[model samples]
Target: MAFSELNLSTELVNAIPNSFASETQIQSLAIPAIVTQRDVLALAQTGSGKTLAYGLGIIERVHATGLQQALVLVPTRELAKQVVDALQPIAAELGHSITVICGGEDVEQQVQRLGDCPEIIVATPGRLLDMIRKQLIDTKRIDMLVLDEVDRLLDMGFWPDVQCIINDLVNRQQTLMFSATLPETLQAKVTKFLNNPLKVTANKINSVVEHIEEKLYLVNKGSKTNVLIKQISEQKWPQVLVFIGARDNADALCKKLNKAGIECEALHGNKDQAQREQVLLAFKQGKVKVLIATDVLARGIHVDALPVVINYELPSDPSVYVHRVGRTARAGKAGLALSLVCHGETAHLEAIRQLTKRALELNQLQEFPVTDKPSTGENKRPKRDKQANRRTNQKTRASQFKGKK
Candidate 1:
């Protein structure tokens, strides 16, 4: 189905770019439900045009009366900005405006912007709740509430704040929740938030995209950095996103890569908004070849046609492995995801295999052989000193004899 057949206004349909020929599965299913004012829980892939699915509905329904009729709560400031950018054109065509409320921006300035009473507000939960507590923005009159990337928001521990904000929206008429995966915990929250909602899924949850070629390289932890540098030099991908388990690892790996003559940058929660934006812009503009980032900061990253994603360190949770690799092979583009697995991380690799339901074969790099032994699980408990045990037994016998005497 096309945007023109989705019951959208002529202006909104014209506002949609001509490049988007037909509606994606998520968009085709979601637009009709949202236009009819029904709650929706959409489970779609990372790059399946989810932003447009809801953005079109929002523009079609919201009035330009400047009363903040719609609220879109994303997981990060970058995503908030992306959502606003996606909606701005259509919103402008319809005479409605969107204001972004998120962290890492001046709250007072946000307050000043709130005075304009934009018809739509795209925000992160923390700053939006802060504004709500400060009485700067009222949510009671919000007609539609959108929780984009709901799983990520919950993963980031925004449930309490999300619930608090939802409580204030006593008059909300519609709720739309979108996520890549719907865990049981998220399902419970969805039950509470959505009322008789339509569940729309575009692809298989927790599975990698079909276009992505996944490979696992087994190397020792000591040689992970060396192996990574070797792989990058060998592959010579124009743009690669490397995911590290920690922020310090991201910084350390970035430095090592740069020292190896690779133009790289580090992105994490520690970097300020401007620095983060600069790094992303540089990577996007091809000024930087590799971007090393932790999962938290990488959640909001949306790079077009990014060819490679390397897991420098595996996440403890297998599902996160899916999310990390999902960064590439987006929008039906062919991509590659390479995971550097160490002997100690076999368990992690196993978990990922189970979650993704893929028989992942371990490919050993001839230059980077694995010398480390796999964990036997027996060494988890410290070995007792046999000599010390013998001495203790003798001492106990002697003490018992003395007591008898």
Candidate 2:
């Protein structure tokens, strides 16, 4: 359906890019409910136009005269910036101001910005809570509350802060929660926050995007980096996002790739906001061909036409694996996901297969053989073979002794 039919302001509609002329399913379903100021819980996959769905809804409801009419809570600082970037133009067109309050930036600067009382405030839970505690920002005036990536917010252990912020906003008129998947723990919180909310699911929960082709390479732990470099050199994908398990691993992997003559960068929490932005900017502009990142820090990243995603280390959570690979093949474009699996990660691979409900075949690279086999409780060698080996050793000793004699 056309975005024009969504009852948005003419200025806001005009602000939308030509590429987004037709509303995505999430936008079509969510815009109307949100426009009416109803509580909404939307479950949609990554890269499914969720930002626009809520951004336009926020613009439609926010009045230029109001003080902090809307509050958008995201999981990470990167996402906070992304949401602000997505809504800023429409906000300008509507003459509504939007401000971001996230971590890693100068808190005092955010305090100064809060003096203006922006109509829309996009923030990460921790920094927003800090502002509330310090009496820098007033939450009593906030009417609409949006929890973008709610699952992620909980995953990052922001539940306590989120609840505290919600309690402060006793006058909230509407609550909107959007996520790719909702775990049982979050359902109770959802019940507590949203009042008679409408639940909208644009796609199946925890389902990987259909357009992504998934492949697994089983290799030894030591050989993962070599295999990754080999694949990058062979495929020559223009832009690739590689997911590592930890911050240090991201940095180390990035260095290894660069030393192997591939242009790469690392995005993780250790880097400050400015550094993170520069790395992302370089990656987006094609200056950096590969971006190695940890899953949590990469929450807000949205790259267009990203051809590939590599899992250097699979996340322990099966759902996280889905989210990691979902970065590719977005907007109906075909993408590839390659995972480097070691013997120890067989369980992780199995969990991913079960969660995605797809038969992912394991392809072994000839150069990097899978030397390590998964361990079972019992020894794998047969008792007869063990006895025969012992007898052969005794015979070899006897023959050597006779020759010496």
Candidate 3:
């Protein structure tokens, strides 16, 4: 569908490059409703163009009114960056400006940006509240408030920060919220913060992308790393993302993979903005072959034609599992999501199975040894062969005797 079909201003529509031609279901439906000045609650899978759906609404409204009147609260610094990057150009085309306020940056710079009176602010909840507390920004002028990834914001325990920001701006505004899943807590927040809202669900809550070819590898824990390496070596995937459960694991796994002659990078919570951006930018540009990350960096990331997503470690939340796989199969392209399941994680794998409601097809490893456990009577660390040991001892004795004589 064309951007002009949404009835946005011609300038706004033209500013959007041809890249956004194939609008996702969420955007196709929600964009028009949002542009009509309706408060929206959009339910769609990650990578479904929800960001641009609401971003266009925020930009169009602010442009028409010619005021600094929009605020978007996101869950992570990376997501905030993605939202701002997607919307800033369109806003610029309409002669509007956007200020990004998130953690891991110089606060003084944000303050300076606020002083310039940007037309829109794309921010993370914590840093937004921090700025508000310091009197660095004014909430009174905000006529449109958005909570992107509301479920994740609640998961991160940003309720107090979100509430504080909303209460401060309660006088009057339109509220738009988007999430992969809407739990009761977020529903309650909607009740308190939003007036009568229009709801739109572009996909079922438990839906998995059918375009992704899902595979599972049931390998023993000891050789899982080798199995992953073998899989990557066998295929010349242009860009691969591996999801580990912890930040330290992500770093260590990247090091191990790179040591095996596979160029890779790690992304997690600890990496500062510059490092994260560098790795992500390089990976997107195909300069890096693999990216190791935790679930924190997985959501709302847009990469073009990334064919492979490996779940090195599964996330506890099923919703996160959906998000991880959704990173691939994006923009109407076919992709692959492969999971490696060891013996100990059977129960966790079962949960994922129940969540997706589809039996995963297992793929056997390629001639790699599986170290399940020692045989019943066999020693884990057996003694060396007796003949070889005896020969070594005899040679040592002869040499000693010769020296003594």
Each prediction's Cα RMSD? 4.4, 6.9, 8.6
Top candidate on TM-score is 1
lDDT of 3 at 103: 90
Ranking by TM-score: 1, 2, 3
List clash counts for every candidate, in order.
0, 0, 0
Instruction: Find the number of clashing residue pairs for candidate 1.
Output: 0
Pairs in steric clash, model 3: none
Q: Report RMSD for candidate 1.
A: 4.4
Positional deviation of residue 27's Cα in model 2 after best superposition, in angstroms: 0.9
**Candidate 2 residue-wise lDDT, 172-248, digit = tens:** 98999998777667678676778899999998887888888988888999998989999999998999999999899
TM-score of 1: 0.92
User: Candidate 3, residue 363: CA error in Å?
Assistant: 3.8
**Whole-model lDDT, candidate 1?**
0.84
Please give each candidate's TM-score: 0.92, 0.90, 0.88
Candidate 1: residue pairs that collide:
none
- Alpha-carbon local distance difference test for all models: 0.84, 0.85, 0.82
lDDT of 3 by residue, 251-290 (tens): 8888889889888899988988899888888988999889
Residue 384, candidate 3: how far off, in angstroms? 35
